[model samples]
Target: MGSTKHDGDVIILTGASSGIGEVTAWELAKRGYRLVLAARRADDLGQLAGAITQRGGLALPVPTDICVEAQLERLVQMTLDHFGRIDVLINNAGVAKAQDAATPTNPHIDMILGTNLIAPMRLTRAVLSHMIPRRSGHIVNVGSVASYISAPGQAVYNASKHGMRAWNDTLRREMKPLGIKVSLVSPGFIRTPMTETVRGMPMVGPETVARIIAKVITHPQREVITPMAYKFLIALTTAFPGPSDAVMSAWRVWKW
Candidate 1:
């Protein structure tokens, strides 16, 4: 009861222009999900929607920037107007990496926090107003292994994921009685466009991660981990803190 469970379900996905988000949207469509795709790149989103339609899937492209509340609200509003209700909202539009004082121009801290942390929370808030009354909905916040095993060179990215993790954990308790499921999916390494930017790491394909995400949403799990091996790694790290910390430190991947 993974993707197939979503047949006829109205789903909203962000970061649909490329990477994991794009592949997830496609995966859900193949499983018969009526989709609403959102991204900052309108052209990319349009092409994506068109591609899905070409494959005989139902989808709509909405230009949106997660950093902005208005755009996010519009995304939620349009989904409701177009599909009448949103059964699932995939918060897959967050940043994966970032900078620190090791460099002079460490990019804009505000932008990192804004896009990676603030936006997803706002989207959750907006979606809940509608979801609560229906008493049935699912929210999947696409996170990373970085959320728990965070490191240096990506401070804000880790913080944002940690925030999402905490928020979802609490929200799970709050919404469980209301019939809304909250899921936080943390994938290890997936070969999306972002994977290319990652330094010195083997990668998993976007389609692979998308499949797991679809599975989690349909089955309503508290957590979904991809590639399988990462689960053992997480357990190992949790068990032997001394060795785990030493290895990550040696690699210069300071756990955050």
Candidate 2:
């Protein structure tokens, strides 16, 4: 039922210019999703949209900076104006800085929290008014394995992801009664521009993560952690917090 319904579904995807979001747009387009691509890079967004359209998929590029309140509001409004109804909202825009919290720059903290956590929450709120009335919608949050496994030098990044995970979990339970599906995709290391300096990690390609995200939208689930191996790691860390902390602490690559 869910799968069939997702065909030709109207979706708004943030951070659609590159990385996981860009690949996810391609994956969803192939699966028959009509996309509204949002990102700060207008040129990249336009090219991606044009390519999707050339392939007989529907897409519109709306340049957006999710951290800005006005931009986010306009993004939701534009989606509603263009598509009339939005079936899914892919909250994929995020930023990460591998630095210690001890430095404590206001702009850095704001950028991380605003883009990764606050923007998604605000966008979801803006979209929910329309979705709740219709009794149908899906919110798919692209999170990180860092949501579960805390790493050094990623204090702000970890906090944002952990908040995203909590929000997704709570929204899933709340929206169940409203007939809305909330899903979270927590991927481990993925090869992207943001992770270019991260070497020798167990990384999956963006396309793989995108495919999983597409599947999650069609067949809704509460959460999914990519690469599968991370699932066991999550369990191990959860059951033995002290040893897990010790291991992560000793891992020099993850240190600042």
CA lDDT, candidate 2, residue 206: 98
Worst 10 residues of 2 by lDDT: 1-10
> How far out, in Å, is residue 171 in model 2?
1.2
- Write one digit per residue (lDDT tens) for candidate 1, span 1-256: 1246458899889888999999899899998999999999999999989999988899999999888888898999999899999889898986655465355244566677787778888998999999999998999988888777766667677777788788889989999999999998888877776656566767778888788888887677899877788888889889998998788767744222
Look at candidate 2 and tell me the lDDT of residue 77: 90
Q: List the residue pairs that clash in candidate 2.
A: none
Steric overlap count per candidate: 3, 0
Model 1 spans > 4 angstroms off: 1-5, 101-107, 253-256
Local accuracy of candidate 2 as per-residue lDDT tens digits, 1-256: 1224567789999999999999999888887888999999999999999998888888999999998889988988998898889889999999988777678588889999999999999999998989999999999999999999988788899999999999989999999999999999999988888888876687778998998888888788888899899999999999999999898887734422
